[model samples]
Target: MNKTNSTKKTSKVGIVGGGVAGSTIALRLAEIGVEVVLFEEGASLVNGPPICHLHAGGNLYREISDQQCVDLLKQSIDTLRVFPHTANIRPTVIAVPKRDKGEPDALLSRLELLRNTYHSLIESDANNKVLGEPSDYFKLYDQDTLIELASRDFPSTPSSLDDWMIPVAKNLNLDEFKYPLVLVQEYGLSVFRIAATASLALSQMSHCKVLTTAKVNHLEQCESTSQWNVHYQQFDSTLGDWVTGYEHVDYLINACGYKTGTLDNLAKLPRERMVEFKAAYVTHWEHSQGTWPEVIFHGERGTPNGMAQLTPYPDGYFQLHGMTEDITLFPKGLVSSTAANAQPELSAPFIKKLTQHWQQDEVDLRSARAINHMAQFIPEFSSATIGGKPLFGAQQIPGTDPSLRAVDISFDGINYARTEIVKASSALSAADAVVDKLQKLQLITNDQHTSLELSFPITRSLTLEQVENFAEQLAEQRHYPSALARRVAF
Candidate 1:
């Protein structure tokens, strides 16, 4: 490690992990002239677990509380304002399957609550109306209306809700689900776009140093200076060996996603958290030529018949997630940190999938199961074949509860904060919480341009065309179809 004392005084914040949590904080802090150093073990940022849906209203997860859904709505709006280019601008369809105990009417109260909350947010700030008009935040269509829509032709570009619903009505087995299919303004979020945008923006920022493909080996706090020394190693291509280095900063943030507990263990801060390993499989439906909204068939999680999600991508690609033990979730996927070690250790098989390559047979098996899960509702979807490798990774949920969705930053001390974001949309709120902490510590001023303005200097420097190009490039680089970087309808 380089023990250079020259740059110690200027280093303000050091972030470990280049996931959305760490990337958002680095971008937000750097926007206000704060010096930041972000470390990512991966080659790129925001390459963690797949973040397909924006979760604008948390309608997908029926187990979560109404308050959590409301919080998700607000946080998702904040995310949209900052990264407008990432929004897919397509609505989501939430349906209760006949096999499930949930009634469609039971969801009406929560949808109404979300709509009212959305209206209130828009009333407070007109800019919060990114998910379309507040009045159209959600729409309900009875079985009869859907049956009528099935007879209509699917448009190439959907101009109205009925046009978007036509594909769902034609493809989906309406008899298998209850009446009143709810279409919400919840949009899709492109993880590739976020990765491209954050990587580009951070590269251009003078005050922020983005260290990709660098692994943090150790962390030590200086007793006298009250600063953190983040020790990391990067591979030197010329030397064909790893080079070690360290950065000293006044504040530290452990945004390591599932591995956050590793730093807490190193700091000897025994914190309670859970890590879950989840995967979403990609499939290509050649027969489906029309644009379809994101479809959700509600079922009890962890059961044989679990919630099946079919998220559409451009060019016949769709991501499927079956919330059963043998599919997207595993037998011991959710693990809690022990008292001795804050880092909850996943089994070798799960770790292998995360760090190393997943076995071809396992991918094929799980993906087939996911396809069948979706085929339960859309019988024609049984023919869909595997499109690409599964988007898989582990995520850190702050508490022991696996269902917790809404979370922000939690501070261990005045200078140390840990990000525990369950959903990607919560990343901006976690970043704002870090900013608030900095303000409280008198490190960053109150008037330091903290607002999430659409015209931020760094984001404004790039156009939507540039974002599209970079996002497609990232998707291709990651071995995924470039079409996955695009919106379904728009």
Candidate 2:
């Protein structure tokens, strides 16, 4: 366990939910000499949808505005600085399919802009050079170069940019894509590793108490002391019933992802928000060359020709996401809150898929569709089979705009802040906003504490082997293949 700081504790904070946002906030607060009580309904933390891509430059989504892309780039760098072990350090391949109306050259301006932004970040702080040299932020490959690389065999280990592109050059059907295919520095993030890291870190924090299998039942503001009384029911298997308890906290932070409205309704705060249900399939392919860069065949989203993504994992396991309505998206998958209720109501089928086991037939059918979708680009992937159950969940977008990727903390009262993060990378920004709010309210004092400035006590102390073992155990506990926890090194 990480030792408590010599600084005196100031105030108590109550946080609901144990997703990335909650976990990040709890650790930051506890590390800065604040008492935190984190409540998680699930047995573990960060057990939501599978997060594979870092979106270092938001290159995958061309529809979002340039500002959102830059914001994502900054947040992604901060995330890597905090959880360096969770990164799968490989570039991503993006190609425009022949059938798609988009052109490859149109992306050049944005790539150049991203490269400049990265250079500026590095100039400010040399440590910000996490994604590698700004000069190598992205590289373009002509058809002739790809053809030449295709003739060479896959190397045992990849050392250069060309080395990483070998599998893509050999496997991808060049005729189907436009020339000048681009390779960006965007990498992959292992959700299992993040869960393990958060669990270990929270356990060691001296002022942080993580209560798993505990659900918040009620919240009441104390008129006398101005503290909030948090009532919760923790399941006790021995008694076969839920045991009720309460905690008093000077401030409250709602970090629930999709269920943020539950706490909002309890506080009688009205807000406009939308929730989206999405999933990505996992497949195993016996590829002679084990490692491959994340491949993207960009097409319009929700249409028949939607984007198809193939994310590589260890042990020949790959995760796939087809953005078509029939694949990762479903009918009525995206819903918004009605004026009567702040909580958006997902269909019963989606709720069942989220809370219970997915039907095996549906999984097989969807997995097959994803396979066929990728096989169109890489024929060898046609033989891949389902590796595990789908990684599915409902994510909350702060506003009604589904295209909005950037979000932060919103204050409801003097002591209450609600975080609505669209992507996992935005968690740190949300936490920083809460920290700033705490200081403004005089709930905590310490102007010098920053995520970048202060060292992460738990993650810094853990070894790679310990993280791998714990991540594998988390994967098994969550009914996923253990290979998902292993790092992909080539």
* Candidate 2 regions with alpha-carbon error over 4 angstroms: 1-10, 288-290, 447-453
Tens-place lDDT per residue, model 1, 8-109, is 325489999999889999998786677899999988898889899999999998889999999999999999898988888889998898878999898899
Best by TM-score: 2
How many backbone clashes are present in model 2? 0
Tens digit of lDDT per residue, candidate 2, span 154-206?
88778878988999999888888887899999989889988888888888887
Query: In candidate 1, residue 258 scores what lDDT?
Result: 93
Worst 10 residues of 2 by lDDT: 1-10
RMSD of 1: 3.6
- Model 2 residue 350 lDDT? 90
Please provide TM-scores, in order, for all candidate models, with all chains considered together: 0.96, 0.97
Residue pairs in candidate 2 whose N, alpha carbon or C atoms collide under 3 angstroms? none
- Model 1 reaches what TM-score against the true structure? 0.96
